[model samples]
Target: MSSSTLGYLARRAAQKERVRILYRRALKNTLDWAVHRHLFYCDADELRAKFDANKHVEDLDTIDRLINEAEASYEKWQHPDPYIVPWAPAGSKFTRNPAPPQGVEIVYNYGKEESD
Candidate 1:
């Protein structure tokens, strides 16, 4: 291949990589938002117990609704949130620092902190 062709191919490859990374980051953010919202609005223990007792239909429906609401909220807030990375022109000088998944504090504090 000619030098110009090779350079073009390389640039295209780099652009594709950047696009893939952006897409993956967006998907991760969306999933994290949904999971956090679900946990926030639902009683996990009670839901689990109901599931174990074969009474999960209503709980499942409620969980679905909560997830939908959470997704809507995420979409609304994502544009303005610093934690969410916005799509920029290729080679732009922007750094992405996605927020960590929610509910992490509860897991980290499991039995470690005494309740008042």
Candidate 2:
């Protein structure tokens, strides 16, 4: 194989790794939010008692429903703003006026015009 082919494969692998990392992070964040919202506030001992009372049944339809609702709420909270503002402190050297990229060039157009 040529060096350029190897380089292309390497870049593709790196890109896939980055995408996997982002997906894992997003999943972790969602799960953390769901658990924190649903179970973290409740007393663990009480939860254990409830589980024991139910004989540790794996049929958690109710719990699943509650968790689904919590996940929806978490999604709402996560994307409150369409734009993500920087967390940099005021007057920080890195804190500059945040704006979208000046000009975004589309490398491979996907059945859409450049202006579109």
Candidate 3:
């Protein structure tokens, strides 16, 4: 194939990957806003429908435009206070009790060291 054709194929592949990432992020963001399983399912279905509707587009320019619009929409509607797992990074309980530094030992039995 010609260099132009190769470049086009590469661009298309990148665009497809971006779309996949965007969809996943949007779905996860949706979960942050959904309080119940049924509600999450409904929202997920609607989000899937939106992506499916654009699945058949073959024009690169159109695909790029659609992706941009979808990203913008996602940004505008993202949850203000998203739900985060307590153990995950940036969560409330993350790194609450970090491991001690090297050369430091913690005695579990209270006063036993002094008594000994």
Candidate 4:
């Protein structure tokens, strides 16, 4: 358990963590472009394949480089407009009361008649 060996292990662990975080972010970003469940499934599968193809590299230097490259590509191709939940406060459909169409009459008057 030399100091140098411990440092190497720590660095390797940090690199692996960075890669995992990057992969999760990339997958979430893919959801921005795929609205439907089927579309998201297909897109996610392709993204997984791309990541799996590079999973065998044991060299830390190459792993760091690959992570940097992936991050750059993700930034470049990020969706300009991502979908927001309709019920979320930031979404366009978020409202306590929606506006009615123009020229439509809304009546709130009620009359009750009782005859015996």
CA-lDDT, candidates in order: 0.49, 0.48, 0.95, 0.89
Q: TM-score of model 1 relative to the true fold? A: 0.32
Task: Mark the 10 consecutive residues where model 2 has the least summed lDDT.
Answer: 79-88
| Backbone clash pairs in model 2 (N, Cα, C under 3 Å; residues 3+ apart or in different chains), count | 0
Which model is ahead, 1 or 2, in terms of TM-score?
Answer: 1
Q: Please report how far candidate 3 places residue 37 from its true position, in Å.
A: 1.0
Per-residue lDDT for 17-69 in model 1, tens only?
A: 64445444444554444547666345444433433453333343454454455
Please give, for residues 21-82, the per-residue lDDT of candidate 3 as tens digits: 99999999999999999999999999999999999999999999999999999999999999
RMSD of each: 21.3, 19.3, 2.6, 6.5
Rank order (by TM-score, best first): 3, 4, 1, 2
Off by over 4 Å in 4: 86-89, 92-116
Per-residue lDDT value at 26 in model 3 = 99
At residue 81, what lDDT does model 3 achieve? 92
By how many angstroms RMSD does model 3 differ from the true structure?
2.6
Error of 2 at 54 (Å): 43
lDDT of 2: 0.48
lDDT by residue for model 4 (5-92), tens: 9988998999889889988988989999888989999999999998999999888899889999999999998889877788898787
Off by over 4 Å in 3: 100-105, 109-116
Winner by TM-score: 3
